[model samples]
Target chain A: MIKPTLHSGEFTYPEGTYFQAGYLTQKNAGWRTARPVLDTNACVGCLQCYLHCPDGTILETDDKKVTFDLDFCKGCGICAKVCPKNAIAMTPERGLSQ
Target chain B: MNTRELSKNEYFFGHKACAGCGGSLAVRIALKVLGDRAVAVLPAGCMSAVGFNFPQLAFANNAIISTFAGTASMMTGILAGLNARGEKDFTVVSFAGDGGTADIGIQALSGAIDRNDDILYICYDNEAYMNTGIQKSSLTPYGARTTTTPPGTVSRGNEFRKKDMLEIVRAQGIPYAATASIGYLQDYMNKVEKASKIHGTKYIHVLAPCPTGWGYATDDTVDIAKAAVDCGVWPLREFENGVYSETPARGGDKAEYLRRQTRFSHLTDEEVGAITGGSL
Candidate 1:
């Protein structure tokens, strides 16, 4: 049997939120900017980088190539950090603030 | 989040933390990355007691205080219990100190990873037991000054080299692992964001320098921390799932990184070479 649980707050997050489990998010947890730009020509679809992105920013499209969610990318550079192909890079967005 | 935006984080203002307390700064950004949907499982350490008296919490959400040695396992159980209740969406975070993480808590931390419980296990590594007093921890580097590893008695502060936690966690074959610092705000924020979305155990070994413990100008926290990276004493690298990748070199003057702090006051050319030899 399960007891009735009394949760104090809602577990909802707004769009464009990034780094859901970091010190910056302890309060709002909703900071993001500069989404990952995946070059299909450069991406071989190995998915190694996809498996390790902490933000869930990267996604495998129906076509099987990888993509990313810009609204939630804090631009922490993890994708670029792990991409074996050196296919990923950080693009400084114009006034793209997180 | 960028430093400009980090200033506006919900937990950024009005709380009291010691001057240049890297752990507190780390916790600030760390908890920010964790968002309000998570529960902070803190052990008996600086991270737990930094103004966390009853009714007065720095965190706005659920935070639990557990034993020093079992924070990881306790968080593992917490995550499991939450998952069973359809509460899997909430993040369970274990913020352990270096003393708790690298030494006493390593066993339980390793076990939790082996179990692959979906949790973000973080070590706000200050290199020593700064809370109980500036004693030595396994994460404490060689030739660093601490009360236990006195320069007078031992010549070099910690006789032994700092244990390699990133490699040790990588050995578990868990989903994600990385080394982050308050110095590199964007990188730190991004890594935590990535860890939260991962499916299994993820570990972040953060290098947080304590001003009080490290004996430096309280305001020099960021400058000193940047030194740890620029000097190559602490490489800002990431290990994802099982793949290892070096972070883009922040390449700066090592002297600036060193001269900013007193803990490294004794770090001469020979000592710097030794530390660099191991990390660079």
Candidate 2:
């Protein structure tokens, strides 16, 4: 589904004719059979997992701890693969909860 | 600078690319470099299939889906409009696959590069049209088997040599042109940062290995990508202002790179040797 028309012509440019640049189609799930779980205790704040995550679902805390936003995490295991400390682990995606 | 120490804002997530997808990884890394100031112009390709799946956008930045051949054209128009609006703070990036870059969109790409448009064009070469199944693209190597170029008694995978896209982009005398691989993260990130900052048509051709298309183990994508570069099968090099600087080579065998992927499973020992010997 695309918002083809910009409903209101409030912008400098014409409303409906513009390309629908940012639209979220559907919440895609059922793709990842496994999901990544991060062990914050062992995490050295190296950020390899955060840097290597294909999906930007990993968020850095103010204290430098990282957490996964499972709403969008596709369970790519890239975080686990790139973690030099093996602080991240991939388990079956039964649910977001470990 | 410690490449890993750089903090980045992630722009792509909640997408549908396969596990260990090098293309998606490349986009992630590129977006990290481009940050919030860039708009990505993508055409019909794998990135489109996964990232721009209609309503659910994975990009934190503005991403426009253009026609298969209109990637560069769209970026050009956007940049021009922004320029007219005195928007000098933003960067326009055209991201397309090997099929979109080397085949369908090459004409527009060439024109944009020739004009030296102030945009970055990233060709994430997965070596085939992976979005439409493993069909061979112009950038597919000579001996790899794609769906269209299946090996049999009469044929041995794709027969044509891969297009030298770095040369093609460089031939336009652009400000910067280079080839990077997803396997080497630090190097890839460094190059992406360099390209994003450079003005006037910088082209980065990235070898994004496809597990589905290349018939490789999903976990081995990065390793295989690294092997390709280290083995000199795909040399990591950069062209800046018409000057070429090759990255120092790493020790690895082309045969090892080929042997890991099932796409090259049909090759005999002699065929692999021929490929390594540059005769195939």
Candidate 3:
């Protein structure tokens, strides 16, 4: 997980604002009530979900199957809804063991 | 640009936007088109509030928060300052919400356009002010219930029509202007790309839905956005070179579109007909 360096009282900070791109120090998986489960066999690499994802958690794998970075996936179910082949399902997060 | 051809890099991500935020999607996609060279200016709206958290900024590209009403003015300043430093191949863009665009920031927006500043100002219209607990703004459509515009025994929600922002900007003779919806991603992407290439001031009013504000299922954000366009509540059109062109609506059922959103659930059939100009 990418984390931000916290400045202590003893250390002097930089004069100017400086940070990395896409700077997220925490996981947002707690926000999900339902998690998207991908069915690799049924996937056709359409990438509609990837395009529509607000969180940018959907990832295209080397073999053309799509996976997700659940650490930041808020599980908005957009991937499931936009899936043309019904390969993605939004399973309730309560019962599932990650 | 199609889905496959879009930039693999995620410029806007890892923020605290809601599960299915249409505004975030608009920002993410627009930034994707604009790329790293784009210097984004967001006002005190959803995108800014959720994006620029103190230590964890969501935008990969250079971005900053402007005053609530100073979005366009800040963009003008950025353009001027960058030009002074001899900067090139960079787009100065602002992502402001409906309240910021139509209500508080209209004057500055008008001023920027009047001066014909080189910038792209995209207003992600989510109907109401969603960041401050769903208050009604000028862009809120008729018959939609908000915290400020509640429907009661005698009063219907948001009695006024949505402000025609596209026409308003076009009236100022902006070089390019268009209306886009997240449901139609390709069209919106094309509009963003086209606007980025234009020399003078360009404006794109995108109809972004808010699941929390609109009282709909979170997953239905894109679906509802598309339905608004198809039902004629939000028309997809473009204004360029003093001419107006609109994509014909698919003529989707307006009543069904309203029925899906709880904000409009209180409306009677007669009231729904009234909202749709008696076409229903």
Candidate 4:
């Protein structure tokens, strides 16, 4: 019901430009961001994910297990953001998810 | 558990910036990164008059509006004055427009950089003398429109390429040097933070857009800015000592980037290609 508010730390932006306060958006837990999602049946082994995933999220696998690390995903949504097939949508997580 | 999107009035809303003023955005972001411990060394430009024109100074922190050619000189003095009183916690930021930095202020800028002054000199470059109704300046790009470089049947715009200011300063061998854009707010802010931590001269050239000067609709301010970086004409990079670390060479094609502005509208495909190709 209550969305968490970000604490605008001690430092402020004095200059008129974009700047990161040397901090990432999500850093409360040791876990990294969970970024990508996949649709197994629709994949069709086309190597699109292998070719397009900017961070090498999908590797070539003969068995089609197609392992993905949620933490490694920048959630740039490259897979789903550019998915030619209507597959790979990202959803909010609730578990002790990576 | 918390996400209070930064103070509602970081630039202290209602200071009188034009609808699509990139120079105003430059002032906003610079002040935001420096926070309360910041002292702005402003000069005679649109920014000076933007502050409600009277007592309502837009800058919430300690700020000084000085002469046009004295931004760097005064900033050096201000920093020395502050350091003399043992107030080393605050930052002295020298904010000037391209006309100030690339022309009138060049002498003082050289003096300060020569002395290795402890101040951050940010040149919010809008390409020409925008505040003075868009006259030509040394930083104005080739074949771009300005009052002095108006397009005629024979000419597209200014004949000379923009003077290489970053390279000029790099020759001074200061502690830091960088080029940034308001379009890439995060990248600009990160450099401000880095410059804030350093002890000597830091030259940061921010590509501030001027819809009025560039002859564009007020709404295209941010869009134009992003196109600048995405297009390689303004190579984002930094220098410290002899080391050169380019700000990621993110490439954006020329046409989509330069077409909206009236200044570049007259530029032929070949002209745009020549300027944007390796102008960096």
Top-DockQ candidate index: 3
Worst lDDT 10-window in candidate 2 chain A: A1-10
Interface RMSD of each: 12.7, 5.5, 3.4, 15.8
Candidate 1 residue-wise lDDT, B1-280, digit = tens:
5433432233322223453467766766766667667788889888777635423345555677788899998998888788778875788987899999989988999899899988899899888998888899998877778888887634766788889998898887978999987666578888988899998999998888777787775445555666678767678878876788986656776555655657667777777765655652
Runs of candidate 3 with Cα error greater than 4 angstroms are: A1-21, B278-280
lDDT of 3 by residue, B34-92 (tens): 88899999999999898877566688888888999999999999999999999999999
lDDT of 4 by residue, B142-199 (tens): 7888899888898788988889899999998889999998776667878888898998
CA-RMSD of model 2? 4.4
lDDT minimum window of 10 residues, candidate 2 chain B = B1-10
**Per-residue lDDT of B178 in model 3:** 97
Candidate 2 clash total? 5
What clash count goes with each model? 24, 5, 0, 32
* TM, every model: 0.69, 0.89, 0.95, 0.70
| Model 2 pairs in collision | A23-B55, A24-B55, A24-B56, A25-B55, A25-B56
Candidate 4 second chain TM: 0.92
**Which lDDT values do the candidates have, in the order given?**
0.69, 0.81, 0.89, 0.69
Q: Which segments of candidate 2 are over 4 A away from where they belong? A: A1-29, A39-41, A62-65, A94-98, B1-8
lDDT of 1 by residue, A1-98 (tens): 11111134444553642222222212211343334567777877766444434333455677767776564444545566456676776666766564
DockQ of candidate model 4: 0.02
For model 2, report DockQ. 0.29
